[model samples]
Target: MGHQTETHVWDEELAPEPRGRTWRPEAGCPVEVALAAVSGRWTTLLLRELMGGPRGFTELRTLFPDLSAKVLSERLRTLRERGLVAVERRRGFPVRTRYELTRAGEALRVLLVELYATGEELLRLTTASETRDERSPGRLEA
Candidate 1:
């Protein structure tokens, strides 16, 4: 043997395995699924309002003064599709429709409360920092 050279071919079996905890959101993950369901804009607000009781289209619109009717309608539709909201159409001369939170939606009450508390704490910290900066002798206000 005059000269010998070794060559290696990488294969699936020879590939390095992933280390540490894998963090992928599978379809069966409840937390991931819940987040996906509530990730839409105005979703959390709508859920909070619905948690109180059933609300009609006009009533919901009134709660969100700046939101347009079209957007509200879309949000409601999305919630209904996610099984978080149930819409009941009352047959009357005026034909009123009411939207209420389903059991699944109601379960998010605790999470929402925690979120509100977290927001309050964050706001408090931000205000405190701003006040401290303003009072600093060498700091310039922008």
Candidate 2:
């Protein structure tokens, strides 16, 4: 993935996504950001499953026990619209469909892995801090 070096132009007139906020790059081009759209509850789970390889809708449903078929369909449609996934028909006696990540989506896998690692480290630190806090005595009010 090529990083934007110079300041790419931004349109102040453009409307934000569902939420009323725009993403301004810290030091790069104002390319359309992908985080907000795919950073929700079941989004990462969906992406993680796709990382193993393309799978059919039924297969996806099986992986996420709690997710309803309706919700899965919605998420997949959203991902497709965002260019994060490609949906194609599978040729068979009975026609079926499958979903797979796009190049940009695959790149996001690396970022997700890094985020997972960071989350684990934070949890460990939090647990340690809690243990220390529990053992330490607090001051009494005068």
Candidate 3:
């Protein structure tokens, strides 16, 4: 199917999806910013956990048993640097630290939801493709 590209914004037809000011997605691009926010392994999961509410360091470790404390700390640090996560320290017998998403970070809820839906669609398409390939004439599997 084909579609028209005449719809205008800023008095110009906007660049197609995946294109920024340049061919490559440069700094300050929305795509780049979003990717940077969710770049590292376990980053998205950490965000998801924080999305529920603020969580202490120990709670995060317990929630993700497979994730090492070192890696978990690093991910949280990165999120903080990106302004997607906020950290609060409570003075007590043992100083407690809790992590929560900032206002900008909370906006990622929509993005995560969309990513999940889009991933499901992509997986479905991939599975369908594999089935078609298996039934293709003259196809061989090793």
Candidate 4:
């Protein structure tokens, strides 16, 4: 019988395909790769912004005032290395540089949208539960 999960049923056992025994986060792991691509503060926001169109460093920094310039640069560099973002340097008086999502990055659009929806649902449920608990005196506080 397959291993049972909330959202999936493994045909045999839930294990890494290539790593037969130990599953660890490394370049060879696809799950790790996906998580690494999107794991960082302001990363999803950057990708979301790029979804609309290409943007320059100053433009992104201006849009997100709270995000520091150093952090922004680091995130962009990581994204570029991950092959999720393409950097275009337009030689001019000021040397304009633009950042846009690559094909792989664009593929994450659905994932981001779904993540937002899931988060909203979780928040809604939590709020409703909290409101009920506050109003109900019979509710036990544990």
lDDT of 3 by residue, 1-142 (tens): 8997955443234444534445566887677888788888998899999999999999999999999999999999999999999999999969899999999899999989999999999999999999999889998777
Q: On a 0 to 100 scale, what is the lDDT of residue 87 in model 1?
A: 96
Candidate 4 lDDT for residue 54: 92
TM-score of each: 0.71, 0.72, 0.83, 0.78
The Cα RMSD in angstroms, rounded to one decimal, for candidate 4 relative to the true structure is 5.5
Judge candidate 3 against the unseen true structure and give its global Cα lDDT, from 0 to 1: 0.88
Q: Which residue pairs of candidate 3 clash?
A: none
Which candidate would rank higher by TM-score, 2 or 3?
A: 3
Q: What is the lDDT of candidate 1?
A: 0.84
Model 4 regions more than 4 Å off: 1-30
Encode model 1's per-residue lDDT on 30-126: one tens digit a residue. 6566677778889899998999999999899999999899999999999999888999999997999999998988988888898889999999999
On the 0 to 100 scale, the lDDT of residue 112 in model 1 is: 85
lDDT, candidates in the order shown: 0.84, 0.78, 0.88, 0.86
Which is the winner by lDDT between candidate 1 and candidate 3?
Answer: 3
Among these predictions, the greatest TM-score belongs to: 3
- Give a tens-digit lDDT track for model 4, residues 51-116: 998999999999999999999999999999999999999998898889999999998898889889
lDDT, model 4, position 34 = 65
Runs of candidate 3 exceeding 4 Å displacement: 1-19, 140-142
